[model samples]
Target: MLEQEKPLRLAAFDMDGTLLMPDHRLGEKTLSSLRQLAERRVTLVFATGRHYLEMKQILANIDIPGYLITGNGTRVHDLNGTLLHASNLPEESFKTLITHKWPTAASFHVFRDDGWVTNQDMPELLHAHQFSGFRYQLSELENISASGNSKVCFCAAHDELLALLPVLQTCFGDRLDFCFSAYDCLDVMPVGSNKGSALALLTDRLAISLSECMAFGDAMNDREMLESVGRGLVMGNALPQLKQQVAHLEVIGHCKDQAVSHFLQHWLNSPTLTYSPEY
Candidate 1:
């Protein structure tokens, strides 16, 4: 007798450029498809670099499922708002980042579930605030230093952010983790904390093997989770650098076209559909 294949037990998605459309809205078709997957008992998880509170508000209209691996995996919580796992960058590290005289023009923010704290006021920071829909407090880092924040972020011009990476890596690479959460934003978290680590811990608890899971993503921060899963599907709109960085990743439809939903529908309903790793 042939052995039964391990069923696809979980579907993980990165929000911004993987699941949500360019407008940052969940398309109705995608929502319906997600509901169908939920009904079939396929656990759906959203892993993002978003703050828990901001993600909560953004997903308020939809019944997004399973667990949220937020803050680039510094925090994880269940649908019921139960904290499953959490790791925060040390306060000293946060201070070190905030206090260091950045060689380039950059805006920084420290994030918690309730709100974010920032010491600088810049157009880029304001743009990020609008893009993320998270409120910020204009105060010294010391004022909010006591809060056990999940992460620290730096927003700068594209070129400036790229140039600042080497400096940051040389200075804080040993103590802190850095990920380009967006093209112009860098997120700093604790060492050994990332979306992939979060998924591994959650999967272990769920009694599912990594080979039984699939993940979708579109950015550098999503690399860990996307690469760790048995099947990693990136959006057509994913950054070119991200595409080149990971091996055996397949490019699916664009998020603007609701590729995730279409992919899920086809994946769940069609048995003959197969993934070709030769991208």
Candidate 2:
């Protein structure tokens, strides 16, 4: 049996390669594990770069009661679809990005209590639909100059996104947070905003202590979250730098399917199992 000072109160999972399979589908094993965790009263939350609309489908498939930390950390919502909290970039930042000649096909997304708005044309909006659920409109960036934007995305090649980071940083500075959500997509949010901060806020509202929380991630955006949680798990496919920075090393399978579920089964079943570095 596992020695326990206290039972884990929460389990925050990063979507893409951490919880969902590469095809953006949830496997039966993963869903089963989630059900088990929920039954145990472990507050399961998702801290992902995806927005709520995009996350809803996956949540429906898994069928669990939990909070969502979407847009990296800009937006937080409850399982009942309540908007608990949100952070957004200033209008000036939006204008700057829209006016600037971004290498990739850039898009702007803004969220409020009701829903989100975007300033992309039809073709562009259709492309975004494949990734998120927010309604896309053809409002020009200048028209929404005073609008509050929750997140901005730039879609391009891997190397292209990397190259644009420095430029964006130089232009936006501490005004915005930037990271690649996928190989061809870069996510931007307000500074001082991230999955970790969102988790902190959610924990506070739920009256849960940081020490009682466990989080899983597999990307650079998840870095702060992994560092902030009590036990941060890094997936086997995480970047070398990300793996090196983790406080505790827990090896899990890749994002093919049920990797997280399998690991959790072993973990909860054998609490006495010790963790060792894979590298």
Candidate 3:
């Protein structure tokens, strides 16, 4: 059987760029498709750089038991919000992230188990978190300890973040994973914590093989999970770097057009619909 013909037991999704509209709205068509998949006994996993609480609110439209791989996989929760696995960056990392001389445009945030705390609110971010009504607590970075936190984030202009990337890698690349969660946001999680590793743990516990799973994503953070699954589909709106990074993965329709919803519909009704050939 062609790889895509394999029995699909799980469908993993990355929010923001891959599963959500540019405005961060979850399309009705997408929710309906996920609900149908749940009814079919297919496991649904929403994995992203988002916090669990935020994801919970965003996914309120779907009433079913599913998994949440939040904080880019620093935290994983099961059916009833029971945490399956969690890894936290040490306090030192948080201090360094806070103290580092980031670009003047950078707005920093620390994500802990309780909630997020930011140095200041960047109004531009409102559009992305508005749908979930998730807001951060404003606090000085010095007071925010990284302990119990999944990741530290910095938001700025796209170019500024790109410039900061190599500097971060040079400082802590071996101890942590740095990736762009969005054009303006960079997330730094503990080295071993990521969507791909988290998915493997969840699937192993559920007795599902990697070959039975498919994933969708559109950013550098999604790279590991995309490559780990048997079938990885990259969104047409995926970051250009991501497309070049995972050239072997199939390219699919745009997220703004509800491409994931369309793909799920075809997977259920017509498995032979050809996806964009791998670039």
Candidate 4:
């Protein structure tokens, strides 16, 4: 049981398979849990690899208002559309990506403040959108030279992205951070841009301590975020390596809408558990 003096004040969720179910939709029970948590004054935040505009459409149906960490933490915004922070990649990094020895079958995406820009045509963009339903305003790569970008993404098979990571890291180094947000996609954003950093920024702004926060996730990108919070939960469907990172061995059930909702209801009703850092 958690000490009464230190209660959870915030809950951070990873969007894709963590919060949303296998069908790519939020379940009724999950929504109810969110409402219950809100009434208890626990801040709810959604952290995802998607951009704000893309996340808004899908989350519009929900009634709760909370902070959003989008573009894999490149930008942080509140529910009222207020921008709290953003980290944009340098122009040289973008230039380096465009000129890199990319896999012929791989496609790329660039996210800007106003909209998404991609050199590939709409068909290619559409294919990538299968993984993340982010709305984009496609542009030719030639016209993208002057645009400020927050992130660059490459969509291809896993092997393809793996083949490109070392080369990209070698060229850009500290200028960018790299990860696979989806099974077949590789994302590049400014250094220090990630869900954990965004969470830190939001927590600081809200005056919430790290020990009073809980987070949920299911992928490589979610690793740091899970490790950063007071109580980090990995979904039953998470990768083995990811599951090993959590301090608690408690296994939440499979990631159906019911599973997430059930766990939240139980946790909120249970006594807060004192956090013991594994690191």
Candidate 5:
């Protein structure tokens, strides 16, 4: 139980594994709870590793309005699709990424302002299309430039990705930041760009302090966001690496079980919810 001396004015959520269910739709129970929280004048912001267009598609049916931190925090946008802040990997970093000869089974993706590009036709690409609601154009690596690119991603089997991690880190460790948005997916963004920096930018723009925010996430990419917020709650399904490191983080029910909804419902209904965090 974390103490809340100041009222929680903002609730930031990571999309894929935090707010959305496995099928990518918000359960009625969770949807209702979020709506109610918004109705109470509490701000809701999505701090996710998803692309802007993908985030829009996922929230298409729901009318909940909030800020968006997409592309692993390389881009930040307001509800009306206005770009608040955006960052891109330098040409050198992009060159290094493109130069690498990834395994044939691995799919490389580059996100552009309007859409995304990929090099292979694999099941992972199809999964990306189904999940993101954005069709990608197939382009050769040599033709792909770093201009206007937000983030670069590599998708492979979970175990294969784990094996590839060390190589990637060694090659681009100083130039890029890496985070596992999912077990099978690794996102590489510009250094100093992540959910925490994005959230700080959003809060500064809105005149809110970190102490007045509550964040929820379930991946390694979400570590900074969870740690930066006044109250960071990890979904029961969070990565072992994140859970073990963020010792103060409180565990909630799994995302599939609507843990966020339950927790917010309790916070909205209880005025005396208080406990000091380990950090």
Candidate 6:
């Protein structure tokens, strides 16, 4: 196992595949574990590719308080919903994204400062965001400015997205970053923006170091944050490539089994839990 571990003062989690079940809802066990962590004085932070508003809806009835890193790191907010940092894409890059001719079946979603927008009707997307009650407004993406825009996403079949990935990289390689938040979702963001960078910013603001942080994730979008944390917990259901790369870290049980909750319970109950992560 990877040996580096300091006292964990902060814990970051990715939503969909890492912390949430396949149905995109947080279970009671996980919620209780997170609440216990906060009670122990550990600062809780959610580092997700999800939008802040959606996250708010997901955690609505619960009393769990935490910071949020949204838009795959384009926006960072504190517990009070205060904006700590924001990253915007360049206008030309935004223009390129809006004007690009995407695959006919691909549904495009954009997160802007004003509101969320989509190029077509994607009621299917609502299934995942049901807990959050956050929905996107349909638009032709015309007459929209880039001032507050941060992320653009395309959703299609897993294989279709795989085929389109290379084309996107070839065209906007240096200008933006593309990552798979899910098998079917390809998300694009400004260069240098990601969960890890945003996590670093949050930690810095909180007077903490990455060496004292623990984070859980399950996809390519979670890569940088996993690599940057003191202890990175890779889910058993993680992307094969990601699991292979972070094999040195703990490979927990499948998320559908509430693996994150199990780990947290162990950590909380372990008398040996200290500056080392033996879980």
TM-scores for all candidates?
A: 0.90, 0.85, 0.94, 0.87, 0.92, 0.93
Stretches off by above 4 angstroms in model 4 are 1-3, 121-134, 145-147, 244-250, 272-279
Using TM-score, rank the candidates from best to worst. 3, 6, 5, 1, 4, 2
Question: lDDT for every model?
Answer: 0.80, 0.75, 0.85, 0.78, 0.82, 0.85
Q: Judge candidate 2 at residue 243 and give its lDDT.
A: 76
- Model 2: residue 87 alpha-carbon error in angstroms: 0.5
For candidate 6, give the lDDT of residue 37: 96
- Evaluation by TM-score, superior candidate among 2 and 4: 4
lDDT against true structure, model 5? 0.82
When 2 and 6 are scored with lDDT, the better candidate is 6
Tell me, what's the RMSD of every candidate? 3.2, 3.5, 2.3, 4.1, 3.2, 2.7
What would the per-residue lDDT of candidate 5 be over residues 1-279, giving only the tens digit for each residue?
Answer: 334467878899987777888766677889898889889788889887767887777666577888889888899888788999989999888987898786536678898888778878665455544745677788897798768888988887888888777888888767888888998888888999999999999999999998899999999889999999888999888888888989788888777877788787777777576522222
Model 2, runs deviating above 4 Å: 1-3, 103-139, 143-145, 275-279
- Estimate, for each residue in 1-279, the C-alpha lDDT of model 4 and write its tens digit: 234588989999997778888766677888899889999988989999877887776567566777899988988998787999988888877787776666547788888888777766656445434445665676767578644688888988888888888978787778789987877778987898889999999999999987788888887788778888877777778766567666464456666645667778767665455322221
Answer with 5 or 6, whichever has the higher lDDT: 6
For lDDT, candidate 1 versus 2, the one ahead is: 1
Which clashing pairs does model 6 show?
none
User: What is the Cα-based TM-score of model 4?
Assistant: 0.87
Best by TM-score: 3
